[model samples]
Target chain A: MLPEALDAYVAAAREVGNPSSLHASGRHARRVVEEARERVAAALGCRPSEVVFTGGGTESDNLAVKGIFWARKSTSLSRTGVVVSAVEHHAVLEAADWLGKHEGAQVTTLPVNAAGKVDPARLGAVLEAYGEEIGVVSVQWANNEVGTVQPIAELAALANRYGVPFHTDAVQAAGQVPVDFAASGVAALTVTGHKLGGPIGVGALLLGRDVAATPLLHGGGHERDVRSGTVDTPGVAAFAVAVEITIKTQQEYAARVAALRDDLVKRVLSVVPDALYNGDPVDRLPGNAHFSFPGCEGDALLMLLDANGVGSSTGSACSAGIAQPSHVLLAMGADDDRARSSLRFTLGHTSTAADVDALIDALPAAVERSRRATAWKTPR
Target chain B: MSGGVDSAVAAARAHEAGHDVTGVHLALARNPQTFRTGARGCCTLEDSRDARRAADVIGIPFYVWDMADQFHDSVVDDFVAEYAAGRTPNPCLRCNEKIKFTAVLDRAVALGFDAVVTGHHARLGADGRLRRSVDNGKDQSYVLAVLTRAQLDRAVFPLGDSTKAQVREEAAVRGLAVADKPDSHDICFIADGDTKGFLAKRLGATPGDVVDARTGERVGTHEGAYAYTVGQRKGLDLRVPAADGRPRYVLSITPKTNTVTVGPREDLLVDEVTASKAIWHGAATPIECDVQLRAHGEVVPAVVTVEGGTLRARLLTPARGVAAGQAIVAYQRDAAGGDAVLGSATITAAARTSVAPEAARA
Candidate 1:
């Protein structure tokens, strides 16, 4: 977290009073929350009333999906279709799946190209073919795994033409990229605090004023009846500070990290010549560099790198902590071998050239060992 | 570590002794997500959690190395193949030879680790000779005898000097939660301890006849001849009783004809054992040694001869129920010190003395 945001959060956490109370202490707490909401709105270019505070990006996404789908289904039973991209995070993907299983919704999953971007033309075609039946269209602003930045404005425009609500989980894009909820043409956008240097468990859903949605949590009738519960005053205060600062310095952070990421990628490719750099070459997140090392198991590679003082992550981890091949890579037209051999190295504000060099120094040995430790199929 | 008291204490001891210990639990189960009802299995979801928790308490990095595919291909597949060929295969010994010693150890060495430390109840002398543990009842040298000399060089066994009780006490002292965890028994992959049912699932039930060896008559029927092992007295469910009215035991299984032969317990006795593909720790020669025929089974005094890559041992005293497909691990007996492991081989055949005309069979 940013030091300023952390200080604000710590200071607010010590303060007493529920924002819903009618006493003077309650009024003070209410002012803090309201002020934080306005700051969040101003930074994201959304109306203050549109900022509905949530627990985090996942909660915001769940609310925007399940809440809006339920609300739409209640009015027009025929419009029970949910359109989502193939590379969405499990939060949105699983939410759509749950709706399909329990709510009798028809889900249309649009596939991505080799670069992991959802083609806007596919969205237009789907909407034209099944416009009236579709209730919501959701595609992430940026994929968390491969770091593919989607053409959200075009897709949102296509959904708007069909009179369908568009929601984008901008959790990965909110602070790293320029994300204006009002300008993006999305009806609802999800953003969280942790991604932007704020404390975790605090986020917002930027909902359009006229967009109707049912509440997932019911009681206290907070956030214009979209979200409810006693407000997290400290978390919001810190979130507001983080949002304001991250946006103000997004350009500089991106430029610096992009250089570091590029250097790291070039050096890594040189060391491991057969390594395939995944995702978009130019349109990916500046700090994201993903690779697939053909004979190396991603789990072994990640652990070896971690042992060498370089921390990275594989595509996904099941409940048992077994690393399954990345679904993102699989959606990008890669085979199971490629998906199982991929790793994502994410650079953040604290990353440095020394860190990248450290990874470079560690890559060759880690790759060689991981290749030797290949998937249990070596001929005896 | 195996998520048991012994392994947890082993890791703790290694770390305390100034070694850079990193705890690794082998994720050998093909599907750890399967909901298991009992604690009779290893590498289950519960075992993984216990291992991770123990690592956390010990203040070391922990990882679950997924050896499921390797284990399935080597140990599990070999187990089914051996059974189909009418042999009672010990999967634990196969695992020690193939998965742990070969696969995991090779990976560890490549990853810059000095040694792979385990919690097996076996000792390695200062001169690097493999020996039995102080805890005789829990000694695991028989299974570990399958490891090659090179693999043994990079292996560390920390719980050899202590008994099971001592390890449990150390775990309790160290506040490891698995201190009271029940010891895993039976085949781990067979969750319910139903070996026949497990084999039947893979090698589907092939109906066969059970014949009485002495009378040379069909006595009963079986779903699969692979399910019965030599010397198995229970579950025979024999339809015809012997003339002496004694309980019958399985004598042999012939997979080609899908026939299981049964006889009186006296016929199960064998004074000579022959094993193939012998592995000797150092020098291979004729020696007077004790041979353990199966895991946790009795060790018998025998004169062992190795020739043409085959081991032939003549037992001084006859051992009942000696079966093929089990290992015959040779040991040099040392009463005051733990017995040294000479080497091992897979039992291929066993026979009684030819002088005993009525009982002898090959």
Candidate 2:
């Protein structure tokens, strides 16, 4: 947590008032929440009315995908299908899946190229094939696992041209890249707090006023009736401060973080010669470096590095605690074996040259041990 | 853990003993959610949930490791091939021999754990050799006898000192919901307990003759000769009553001719049994030991000898229902009611005392 955000959160949390109440303290609490919402809206280049507060990135994404799909249903039944990129976070993918399974909606997941980037032109092809049936198209601005930035501008423009709403889960790109909802021409964009520098459990979906989104939750009618329940006052305040500071310093922070990430990737690859870089080389998040080690299992390598105090991920862990092969790698045409042998090291605000040096120092022996564990174990 | 009271109590005991413990339930089924007919059963999603909840009550980390591919290749496929070769294979022994003791134990060690713990009703003595459980009625040393010395050294069974009733009581005390869970029986992969149907679907249903070994007369026809076990009497479906007014029993199965040889019950008694794929815990040859033919089956007082990589046991009293491809675990006498396991071998053939040895050949 950032010091300023932490201090503000602590100070605000000491007070007691529900932002939805009509009393004096409640009106003051409502003012604090509205100020936070306005700051978030201005920072992301959207109107204050466009910001719909929710629990976090996941909730915001669920609302945009499912809510938008439902709203489209009210206007037209023939156009009730959802088209999402293949590498979406499980949040959006699963929401669309639920809409398909239980809510009677058709879903089409678009494929990605070898670099983990969706070709913007594919939207034209999909529109031509299933135009009236395609309700909305969702493509993440930048992937969370591989950090491959998609061509969101062209993709969103294509969706708009086809009179379909476009939604982007910009949780990974909000603070790391320049994200402007109005400029990107997207109907809905999702952003969260903790991914950058804010507290968790507070985020907003930038919903265009012209875009229709039915409520995911009902009661008391919050966030233009798109999301329900009382707004989180302290959480929103801290989230606003984090968003303001991150965007203000994004250029400098990105430059320093990307350099450290690049150095870490280059030196580590040099040490482990068989390591392969994932995602797009030129177009990627400044703080993300993902790799596939030829003979090592991702979890084994992660544990080895974690023991050395270097934090990493083998894609994302599900509820079962099983470290499955990354779907992002498979979407890029990697085989199951290759997909299973992946690791992602993400740089953040606190990353430094010393951290990269530490990773480079500890990677060789860890790679050796991980390879020794799984190299012969794959034949079965 | 097998997601029963035994393993749950074993993990709790290990934790109580101040050992850093992590409970791992092996996902043996390709799809764990596939429940068997009737009640909750082995390797189903329900078992995994019970195992996880048991770990939660015990306050230890729990994980489910998917061992389906390893199990299919080692235990399940080997079982099919063995039965098709006219041998009645024990799938549990194969699981203990290949999957649990070898694959899972090796991975547990590689993952930096000291030992693998289970609910097998077998004890590891202070001498580090495996002995029969104190609960003689539920002793599991027969199936576990296939484990080598190193595997025994790294294996722990906390239920060895307690009876099944006591284990269930301990589980109840620990607030485990599966305390009264019924014990899982039969081959886990055979969901319906119909070994014949499961194998028929895999090996195909081929009709064969059930013949009288003594008279060389065909008595009944069977869908598959491999489906019959030695000493089985009820399912023979004989065409006529025996000449001596006695019931017939399956003496041997010959896969090549698809023939099942049946005769009077005496033919099923074998005083001499030969085995292969021999594994020993101590010396290669168990000098004088009690050999058990089946899991939870009788222990035959026998003299064991090994020559040219083959094991032969000469029983002082003939052993009944001895079948090929089953483990013959060797045990030695101890102060306890049951003997201590010395080693084990897979049965290749068995011989009755009076019959011409050539006639015993299927």
TM-score of chain B of each: 0.96, 0.94
Candidate 1 per-residue C-alpha lDDT over A283-374 given as tens digits, one digit per residue, 9 for 90 to 100: 88989999999998888888888888899989887666667878898889999989999999999999999999899999998998888777
What are the clashing pairs of model 1? none
Q: Candidate 1 on B56-147: residue-level lDDT in tens?
A: 99999888887888899999999999999999999999998998888888888767688888899999878788999999999999999988
User: Can you tell me the CAPRI class of model 2?
Assistant: incorrect
Considering every candidate listed, which one attains the maximal lDDT?
Answer: 1
lDDT, model 1:
0.89
- How many clashes in each candidate? 0, 0
TM-score of chain A of each: 0.99, 0.98
Q: How high a TM-score does candidate 2 get?
A: 0.86
Report lDDT (Cα) of residue A313, candidate 1.
88
- What is the C-alpha DockQ of each candidate? 0.42, 0.23
Predicted structure 1, TM vs. truth: 0.95
- Candidate 2 chain B worst ten-residue window by lDDT: B32-41
Fnat of the models, one by one? 0.31, 0.15
Considering the two chains of model 1, state its CAPRI-style docking category. Answer: acceptable
